[model samples]
Target: MSPTEPIYIADETVRALIDEQFPELAGRELGRRYTLEDQFAMRIGDDYGAIFPRLPGRDEHYARVVDLITPHVDRWTFPSSHPIATGVPGHGFPYHWTLVQWISASTAGFVPLHAESARPLGEALREVHTPSPADAPLNPRTGLGLPELEDQFSSLLAFACDRGAPENRSIDADAARAIYEEGEAASQDVSFTWTHGRLEPRAILSDQGAFAGILLWHNFGAGDPAADLGYAANLLSRDMHPHFWAGYGDVSEATAARARAFQVFAALRHIQIDDPFLMRMAWERLMELGLVHEA
Candidate 1:
């Protein structure tokens, strides 16, 4: 299949795959599909869920990511849905898929965690930011420091100003540029650590304002820990900052600056997405951070 073409696996095909490879799971209820850019997932009965890659090789990539992070799962205060079973390609399904323990919790995007919830999140992040092995996966976009990502950030920033921002919303390009430059300056002493590359609102699972579990390990790798910290910090309310920093422990001023810069870049990148909720959320985050103001 062409890489650009969207892969489709119908409900019948998933059912057949379940029956063929996971006979024990047969006849269980299948829930609605949740789609993302690189993969999609559906609830398989009450106890499990299945994730299928939308692009070729993503399944294998995810498998590798799972393997790398599994050892640390026990150390984390929060739970994660690593794969319990791997499904082979069959019945016209072109890539491998996985079955995982279904987590019954709301996501931060929906629940909007309360101030107290930031502590566990900070503690979890502190654990996750441990030094990684030499062979740890590195996603350039999320792993590299702002200096390395300048070109991409520039492109996205231009795109946001030109077409992505909401109507009548004008991003202070000069201020954005200044912040990016400051972040770049602060990111000079880069330290590599395990990072949840896309630690955003949707990836964070919560229960009634409490931190519950983390979802999606596809982007788990080694990078500047600030990227993850910045992304989460941006999602949080300003009042929660003290609690978060207390749990995560002391952070250098440079690291904090880089985190802010990364959040700006992430906001720009998210603006390019077609999802209304994501676009609005990213834009609002940017505004809240002082990158945007009244027209």
Candidate 2:
């Protein structure tokens, strides 16, 4: 497959895999598609979801991490994906896949995890951000300190400024650079913990206007907790910051600054992907932070 082209797993291929490897689920209906980028995911009837990596080696880490985390989800005050089974690469699919118990909830992309749920989000973060074991996996993209990502961040910023931004919008490179520099400098005192790695709105589930569950665990690994904090910051309004901090406990000023930088990093990704819902949110965040403005 070409680098820019996403791998396509036809419905027929999925059915064949199910029939061959998980015969018990063979005749069941395939339901909603949950994701398509880093991996391909879809619901299997009413009870389960199937996840297949778009690239090689993605599902291996996911399976291992999920195994480690499954026991904790029961006490989290919210639902999470529960592993059911695993499948090897076959039926023309090149990567491993996993079957998990599907949790039904509206993605924050549709329902918006409002500030009213900030405390729950904070509490959830505190729970998941506990110290990771020494042998815990590390994700180079989303599971490292800000300083470790400076080169990648610089490249992303340059790309966004030079080519990624939409014709109707502009990214303030100077302001973005300043925020990143501050984040890097403030991130000197790094403390590692388990993080969701990618805590964007879409990965967050909401129900009845409250935080419900977190999905997309491929990015789960040991990293700076502030990275998740920064990603979660996108969902919070200025007034909601106090509520979030109240639940998550006090953080150093440096961590807060680094979180702000991570916030900008996520906004840049929104622009790159042109995801309308998240792009709007990211734009507002940039404007609020004085990093960008109207037109």
Candidate 3:
């Protein structure tokens, strides 16, 4: 199906589902539906939301599924009236959803638009990382404690495992066990965790060297910065540019390590979700870059 078609279909589907599930929303008119290359979007009157059924390998992880839906709901709470809100949701589902809701409510009358007026990959990252008050309530799921991080990491890993790839249909009991154990080890290692305040963008300049809003994703909290960085780095390796990282702050060795680890985990997780496109792309890239070993 064409990208745009899905938006209309999904919008209709969501509207119908919502109407059936919650009749209070039945009379509300959902606005125009638009399709992007990877997602289906709709405007509920002036309210903006999206349906991302195309996200590669997403169906397998309930957390990821919730993550996708959370943003659409959060945006409804605070539509971006301002040219930019300076803070927007980033990576991971629950946290991103929670953060977006918090920022929207805190600002009250403000609407957070894409940074730099036009959305660019780099600027989007900067927006998420722009720090809020230090006393801001940390996401309960990703607070300072190691136990929480480990539990979340393991749960994500387990979810990934449950969504094993076609080749991994049998599910290797040993590998699953190892992942849990290693997840614990990684969480216990304080060096693996790096703390930041919020998501930030890596802006791309226009021909006049003016700020162009680009890549944005969350970049705060105490956890393996490398894991987060590595997740981004793999995306960069695929086609994302270094200019995006240029706007990011210093990258420590520890951060790089964490990023690398996260990259592999993300790859596996994506594969588990049966996202043929992402899986094929990741495997091909790994082979091309000599990152994967042939047995």
Top TM-score model = 1
By summed lDDT, the worst window of 10 consecutive residues in model 3 runs over 100-109
TM-score, cand. 2 vs. native: 0.89
Residue 198 shift from truth in candidate 1, angstroms: 1.4
lDDT of 1 by residue, 95-139 (tens): 777888889888877887888888888988898889877877884
In angstroms, the error of model 3 at 96 is 14
Model 2 misplaced stretches (Cα beyond 4 Å): 57-59, 82-84, 162-170, 187-190
Error of 3 at 233 (Å): 2.3
- Model 2 per-residue lDDT tens digits across residues 1-295: 5765668889899889988999989889998666655777888889888888876546567557666666567666656764556777888887777887788888788888777799888888888888877887775445767777788788778767675334466678888889888988884465678778778878888896688878777666787788889988888766788898988998899988888888888777765664688877777776677766445
Candidate achieving higher TM-score, 1 or 2: 1
Clashes of each: 0, 0, 34
Tens digits of per-residue lDDT, candidate 3, 1-295, equal 4533322233555565445544544656665543433333333333323333333432232223233233333332212221111211222221111111111121100122222322243334333333334454343222343334455446655664555433433334355445434443453333423222122111111223233222111223334444444444434444344565655655544444444445555555444434455565445434443434423
What is the TM-score of candidate 3? 0.42
In angstroms, the error of model 2 at 139 is 3.1
